[model samples]
Target: MHITMHDIYKSFGTNRVLTGVNFDLQEGEIHALMGENGAGKSTLMNILIGLHQRDQGTIMIDDKETYFESPKEAEQRGIAFIHQELNVWSDMTVLDNLFIGKERTSNFGLLNMKEMKALATEQFRKLSVSIPLNQEAGKCSVGEKQMIEIAKALMTDAKVIVMDEPTAALTEREIRKLFEVIASLKKDGVSIVYISHRMEEIFEICDRITVMRDGKTVDTKAIPETNFDDVVKKMVGREITDRYPERTSNLGEIVLEVKNTSKKGQFKDVSFSLRAGEILGFSGLMGSGRTEIMRTVFGIDSLDKGEIWVHGKKVSIRNPEDAVKAGIGFVTEDRKDEGLVLDFSIRDNMVLTNLHSFAPKGLIKDKKEQEFVDVLIKRLQIKTQSSATLVRSLSGGNQQKVVIAKWIGIGLSVLILDEPTRGVDVGAKREIYQLMNELTERGVAIIMVSSELPEVLGMSDRILVVHEGHISGELSKQEATQENIMTLATGGQ
Candidate 1:
């Protein structure tokens, strides 16, 4: 299928999201969509797949003008969208999720369980996924859920597939398998609209690229004719020379320390120390217990046996309230589920953790709350019309900044950031890293858990590798390298 969108225009209330943008995709080719958050990349694709109605545009599929009334309508026409926010029904089994709307029947008005399992199994095998179809979808890790979504899309035999941040939660090995699958699909005459912030993956797989900025088409070029610097400049409308800023922070006395921490069915014998004015990075493969370890430290999960000390004094933390009282803030990996309240306004989400400051008289101060929110919106450069804007409407990058903003001015001494830059654009990522450096300079300790090896190596003053629920190795700033970190994460000698 060859898809072309020309002179597109879309708006939400007073916000003009897309204005006269143009894009095209060739059959059997991978096309990359590049833009900073809120630059209207997702909105354009959503318009194509019938998730949103375009105010004005011309959509031509196979040289015939077509506009789908709904996503199901689009899918029936062989176009499938695998969204960034997962749609797994937590209580349902994996097999059920794979065939939720398009279930196979046994001709007796009942589900054909055997046939469904066989089909799901074959799809998993194609993606090299090892998840059990009988297990509850909620029990799967983020990476496994990502693979499930991919497999579900493939089952449709889609002629055109839109993948949004498909590899954000996947490890290197899983990414390799997914890439191999993409190559096979391409040879079968499948057209893919790949949307990802990973520059390396885009350059490696995509045949052409279209970059957008401020709701307008900046430029389009063939992959062979463009370079990374050129694409970034087009995406952000400026030059970004340094991907990772230089670090100049000095470590101080230990502020948060965990000794022999153990959680049944998760990590065991985890020992670490985070000091003031330092960044400690956690590197590991999928399901390696890095997230679980941090969850326990933040009191979201129980620690079976361990000692958590704050400022050289042992403390008991049974829930998130206690962790907050102890001056620890956590930005969960699954931000949508755990970090912010999506339905609430940006001001409400920002002040959720800092209520103590706004409620000194046993009554919330609206003036104080608005003042604090305004400062953070400016400091973080969060693009929004007003603090009254719902967090759900903000871009992923701005939502992340709101998560980070919640911890600020809360008298926080230690901050735990998990997959901080998972789906943020390159420009927003640089802003986030700059924020981290500024926090450390202000004597706040940061513990970053990342799957991106370059981020771990570039931003960390010290690094720890996890393998099979254990601390496989630890390295200092001078000793860490991508090769050795992978070696330790894979349990090498």
Candidate 2:
């Protein structure tokens, strides 16, 4: 089925989003919607799925003007939305979550468990997914949970599927599987509206691309007719002259060291060192214990056997507070749940890490807090109306800035970042890279764990490859290559 959205206009109170935006999808074709954070991509899709009402617009499905008052109505019309954040219940079994709210029932109104299980199994087989039907949703890995979400879409017999950042949390292998599923869906004549920030994936999987910027449609073109640089320019409305800034910081003595770190099944025999004014990168496939190592060092997880030394002093960090007191800051990979409190105001989150500084006299000095927040907001270029704005209201890029600002407020000698630019746009990424450069110039060491190979090679002075909970190999900036990194990451000689 062909779908068209014309002159879509939506607003929340005085904040206007999606001003006169247009989007279209062809039957059985994979169309990508590309944009920077807060560029109305989500708003436009929410309108299409009936999550929010468009102030002014027209939605044409199969050339028929249609209005849906709720998501259920849209679903009944064969439109399925696969959210970026999986919507499965953690406590429920995969089988139960698959047929939620639309279960088949007998004449007596009892759920047909046998039929539902069979259908769920068949859907998994169709997608080549290996998740067990009886396993609890929460117990499954992130990639497996994502597969289950796709199976849920199939259970609805959806004709048009809207996928939002489907591979954001997936590893290389899982991403390949997802692409295979998308190809299969296209072969079955199912249209897909894929939204993602990963440019390589778009070039590989999408037939067409639509770009949006600042609440307006920028341009749409066939994949073969355009390139990555051109699309980035359209998305940000400017030429990004440099993706990575020049490294000017001089390497100094070691600032932090982890020796023989072992965390049972999580990771084992991990060892690394960070020098002053150096950006040390940790690269590996997902679930290779990269994140676990960072968490253990930051005191979020206990170390079974290891030693942490800061500035040549052996420090025992039993918790985050201890880590912070040791002059270390960590920006977690899952920013929404761990880095910032979405319900809190920007000012509150900005000062969360260093609240003691603001309340030294046992009472928060509001004027002093405001001054600090304003300076950081300007420095970080976080887009928001005021410090009073809730963190949840900000876009993904701005929210990440808030998290970074929080850590920056607390004076630090070392910083740990995991997937720092996971869901942000290209422009924001450049800004972050510039910030990292500035920090290192000030003699602050940083340890970054990234899945993007180019990012690791571009920004890191030294790279450490982790495989199956161990430090597989180490390479200098001049020696590191994608092939070598992958070889080490996959347990090579």
Candidate 3:
């Protein structure tokens, strides 16, 4: 089922989202849609799947002009959308979640649970997924849920599947499994619209690439015809000469020290020291307890046993507020779910962490708040029309910037970032790396937890490998290598 969209235009109130966009997908081909966040990639897909109406455009499927009034209508036409945020009922069993809304019923209106479970098992077998049918959906891992989502699409006999950031939260092994499943689906003649910010994956799995920028179609090319540099230049409209900024070694006195930190089942005996103007990276595979250690240090989780000292003064942090007051800032990994208040405006999110500073008299000063937001917007290069725009309206990369900006507003001695560039494009990643360089230059210490090996190696002055709730090994920048990191992360010597 070939799909073609021509001269598509869409707008939200006064915001013109997509302007004269053109896209095409060939049958049985895994075509990639590449762009920076807010480049109208989602909007275009939404319009195609009948989630939004296009102001002007033509949609053709199999040589027939078609118009879908709703997502159900699109689904009936063999279109399925697997959202980045998996849509599943955590309280329901895996079988129930798979057959959700479309459950088979008897003549008396009773659910056919037996049929549903059998069908779900069949689909899982087809996808080579081993999730238990009776288990609660929430109990399954992120990778398992992703496989379930794909199996659900197959149950609908979907010919065209739209996957949004499918591998954002997946580990390297899980990603390889997903790629294998995708290969099988392609062989079965299913077309996939793959959207992701990772350039390496695009070259690996996609047959063709479509680049979008600022609500317009920039270029489309075969994967073999173009290189990563060429695709990045088209996406950001500028040549990113450096993937990571050069850092100067300017180590200062120890800023933070954690001795014998332990969290019963989460992590144990974690000891580390961080110095001013240094980037300390924590590397590990999924479920290696890297995030747990950071959470405990940030006061989000209680440490069973440990001693923490800030600038040689022992401090007790019982909560996030206490940590914040002690001059520590944390940018959480799940930015949308944990970092930002989506309903709030850019100004509100920017000043969320430092509200007390703007409201010393117990009432917010609107003028002072706007001035502060204006400066931050300029400083962080957050692309937005006005400070009044809701945070939900911004793109993923810009939203991440707002999260970082919120922490930056509150003066910090140490900063913690977890998967900081998870869903952002290459261009935004360079900007973030430069921001880190700037922060370290001011003598601020940074602790970063990243699953991406290259990012950890490129940005960290020191790397610590975690494995199953313990620090297995530590390496200097000169000594760290991918093989060594992986070996240590997998409980090697």
Winning candidate number (lDDT): 1
Output the TM-score of candidate 1: 0.99
What lDDT does candidate 1 reach at residue 154?
Answer: 95
- Compute the lDDT for candidate 2: 0.88
Tens-place lDDT digits, model 2, residues 1-493: 8999999999888889879999999999999999988898978888998899999989999999987898899999999998765688889999888988888998899999899988988888777777888999877655567778878987888899999878776667668878988898899999999998888999999999999998999998999999989999999888887788888759999999999989998898888889999999999887789988998899998999989999999999999999999999999877766788999999999998888988998999889989999999898778777899999888777888888888885779999988888777888888899999888888899999887888899999999999999889999999999999989999995
Give TM-scores for every candidate, taking all chains together and pairing residue i with residue i: 0.99, 0.93, 0.93
Per-residue alpha-carbon lDDT of model 1 for 150-220, expressed as tens digits?
A: 99999999999999999999998889899999999999999999989999999999999999999999988
The models' CA-based lDDT, in order, is 0.93, 0.88, 0.88
Ranking by lDDT: 1, 3, 2
Residue ranges of candidate 1 with Cα displaced over 4 Å: none
Worst 10 residues of 2 by lDDT: 138-147
RMSD of 2: 2.2
State the displacement of the C-alpha of residue 164, model 2, in Å, after optimal TM-score superposition: 1.5
